[model samples]
Target chain A: MDLAILGAGAVGRSVADLADDYGHRVVALADSTHAAVAEEGIEADAALGRKEAGDPLGSHEPEAVFDAPYDALVEATPTTLGDAEPGFSHVERALADDRHVVLANKGPVAERYDELRELEAASAGSVRFEATVGGAIPVLSTIEDCTPESVTAVRGVLNGTANFILTRMAAEGLDYDHVLAEAQDLGVAEADPTFDVDGTDAALKFVILANVLGGGGFSLADATVDGIQDVPGSALELASEDGRTIRLIGEATREGVRVGPRLVPENGALAVTGTRNIVQIETREAGSLHNSGRGAGGPETATAVLADVGRLD
Target chain B: MDLAILGAGAVGRSVADLADDYGHRVVALADSTHAAVAEEGIEADAALGRKEAGDPLGSHEPEAVFDAPYDALVEATPTTLGDAEPGFSHVERALADDRHVVLANKGPVAERYDELRELEAASAGSVRFEATVGGAIPVLSTIEDCTPESVTAVRGVLNGTANFILTRMAAEGLDYDHVLAEAQDLGVAEADPTFDVDGTDAALKFVILANVLGGGGFSLADATVDGIQDVPGSALELASEDGRTIRLIGEATREGVRVGPRLVPENGALAVTGTRNIVQIETREAGSLHNSGRGAGGPETATAVLADVGRLD
Candidate 1:
């Protein structure tokens, strides 16, 4: 299999490394500055070295990279759903050439799920974004494999950094500010964690899933957006005293969409704490499937992208 | 799609109901006693009536049901492994007839995975059993999606009843006898819970997974099996005091298989309390996908069967 990754960030490099290790020809790797085209598989270690060295991407060029001959595209660019000039141009180019997409970035789907659906349908069932929601959770494929018609709801913690912070606050009586600072220091939280802290990241994910479940376009604005920013310290303490924990729960029901911080039973699956992001999907046939793991991070998201590509190819 | 549900047990009846609701014609439903053939589609509500009226099978004769035409066969009899018995016979007949199979019983695979694999291969890619473990958890399907290569290891709490008893004993500081009696009375444990408490049930599940992951055959004896029966009360208490829980974990590795009781951190994904079952699969590409959900009981298992039939059809 010939693969091209349209980003040199953590997720993109991880996918390249795994694919190259498994003997797949990683033909191209790209970043905002430039892109590298290699018919004889890109060296993942070298790509990492280039990033660490902070060398200008003079030897690489984006136009040639996008024009490279590859069977699939692993899109791991930084999320651009909330912005205009996102990575969709590169993805659109790849899809137009009939290259199947395994996406971790929430840009294309969250911004335009319906248009992408049309593109996928036109291409004969080739595009998948299993990594957009739960890292390596498999919730997307599970819902797709089960009853497609009766998926009445998708709910649970969809953001890892926020959930990790909330878990710390709820369990150890730590302030949210302290936990957020620690998470950023550890690289779990981005320097500007607005999307995750304000629930926009989860809303983007919910939009993608709601489209898949309903087979129709859903606007992020239609969701009842709330975030962990306003969850009171007293509420967390009360929940802890009651043997429960507060998790930033995102849910979509027939009644409508609901996202925010909420109290869950201490022993519930969502309380599988730490950096794990757990999700609970309620379907008509499969009542509820809960998945938990390293819900966020470069390695986990990259693994999901590789799985999606491997499954399709 | 036409569905032929063999065995009117909890799972089969549930599948028939769901398929019929989805406009798939359930042409046949059979039991050990008799069979029901309805070409136009059986009324699920009426079927339930007959089942509850001491005729749990609903006025169906076995011969007539088997003779009916159908597109897919859902074999969901009670699990009795390693025997050329009813479940295997049903699957064999389905395979011989060139019908797709969505199996929910372990007997067919446990007794004859190779023979069944050959039969399926002969007929082409038409048979699947995603509902075999972690009811509605999608562990098998996720692993299949994760990689085309063989899986390296699969470990989890496969048997919900054993885990439930162990969890209850640990939480309530009760003896084995007390917990067993409570579990049986609550209908979580079988009246004769040998298959669950003796590790035989988990071993059977691991054998099936090993076959899928390794493309080879294995027996129950090949697994290093242990159960929660010997968990000393003091040990569980000590683990609990240290914020951990005792779980009966079954693991399949390249070296061998291990099924025994182990201590997991209280907040660990596998430490999911109550009836929830969690599975961790280590694969070549996707490092680990942790699946957790309700693993036992009638509704969860029935939903699993429905999910399998829904996908296969």
Candidate 2:
């Protein structure tokens, strides 16, 4: 497969770097301002190195990628909320050209699924965004394999930042503020962790899941979300006394999506620690199935995007 | 799709009973001695009702199902080891006639995957055995989606009976024998639970997984097996003091397959309790993925078989 990757961030760069290993060629690579477009394969390592050295990927304008010979357009731009501008528009252009779009971006998928699916219906191209939720966990594919309606619910600790904070709070018996600061110091939490700590991040993933399960009628606003911002160490201590611990759990049934700090059995599958993420899928006949893994990382997220490309092939 | 389901046990009955809901017709349903064959689709409920009443399913002989018109043959017959007899021959017959085979039996898959694949390669029909591993957890599909080469290993508590006994021993601080007796009383373990307790059951599943991941050269003999019989309650207590517990864990990699009692983090995802089964697929890029659910049950296993049938469609 030939690939045209948009965005020169960690995930996009990883996708380009690893595309060859997955038996694909990078026809075009871009990072907003400039693009390295070639009918033949582009040198991913050279382009990435140039970007790392604070230079243009190539002399070509970023728009040149649309004309480049490619089979799939990888959407790895930063996630944006509400209108989900650039990502949605990028997807639009890719599908309009009859090229498959594999997304590592959550914005277009979570916020604009209905419009995106509508656009896809009119185009020869199809859209797949396995990396949107739970990073590389293959959550969406599992539901797809089970057939969407057969799976009744998807619930999990999706936000690595919130989970890290909660897990540390429970393990160290430290207050949320202390752990959040430590997490920030360790690069586990961003300096301004509002989106993650306030449940918006996890809510976005679950909302996307609800969209898939309910067939594209959901967004972040449809969710009832609560994060780990106010979960005190005392609550963890209390739950611990009863052989339970509080984790920021996100659940998405067709009816609704919810994310909040809930008490789970201490030794239960849902109570995963550290930055690990897990999703529990409840099926009518299969009971509950769980998929846990690294929810976010460059190479990890790229594997999901590549997997999507493979499926398109 | 029209299905011919052999073995009128729980899984077979559930498949026939639920095929209509899945938009499939059951053309033939059979037990060892009785058969109900109808090209226009059998009355599942009526056939099952007759089965429950200890009467023949119909006047037709079991061999008559082989002549029935069907899209797929669901092999739910009892699993036999070594040559994996009737089950293997049943699958052989299905594929020989160019009919797809969705298996609930583990014998052929775990013991004769190479020969089975060879048969599939030469036949128009294909073979799928998701129910042979972790029941309805979608373990096989997850590996397939990730591409087996990308999955490094598969490891988990794949057996429900062993897990139930171990969980009981830990929770009640009772000896293995005591827990086993109680489990038998509660019907969690069979009266002759040797297959489960001695790790043969879990080993079969892991061997099948190894076959899938490694491309078909494994059997029960290749696995290094161990069980929970020697795991005393004192050991569980000791592990609990260190925030750990023992579970009968099975792991399958390209290199080998192993099933043994091992210590896992008490609150880890692998330490799922009760009869719930979880399989962790270690991938090259996705990190560790876990799928947990009712690994055994009529409707649950039936869902997997039916899902495979849907895939064939």
Q: Which candidate is the best by lDDT?
A: 2
Predictions: Cα RMSD each: 3.7, 2.3
Q: Best candidate per DockQ, number? A: 2
Candidate 2 local lDDT, B1-313, one digit each (tens): 9999999998998999888878899999999998999999998889889878988898799989999998899999988999999999999998999989999999999999999999999889989898888888878887876779889998999899999999988998999898899989998899999999999999999999999898989999999999888887889999999999999999999998999999998877788889999988888877887778889999989988888887774
Per-model DockQ against the true two-chain complex = 0.44, 0.59
Pairs clashing within candidate 1: B34-B60, B34-B61, B34-B62, B35-B60, B35-B61, B35-B62
Error of 2 at B142 (Å): 2.2
Query: Model 1 residue A266 lDDT?
Result: 81
lDDT of 1 by residue, B150-172 (tens): 36898898888898888888888
The sequence of per-residue lDDT tens digits that candidate 1 reaches over residues A1-313 is 7888877787887777777545577888888777778787777677767777997432677667767778888888888754313567666677778778878888787777777777777773378888888887787777766665767888788888888888778767888898899989988898998899899888888877777777756757677888888777778888878988788888865455678888888877766566677777887665677776666767778767876776674
Docking class of 2: medium
lDDT of 2: 0.90
Backbone clash tally (model 1): 6
| lDDT, residue B118, model 1 | 85
Supply fnat for every model shown: 0.55, 0.71
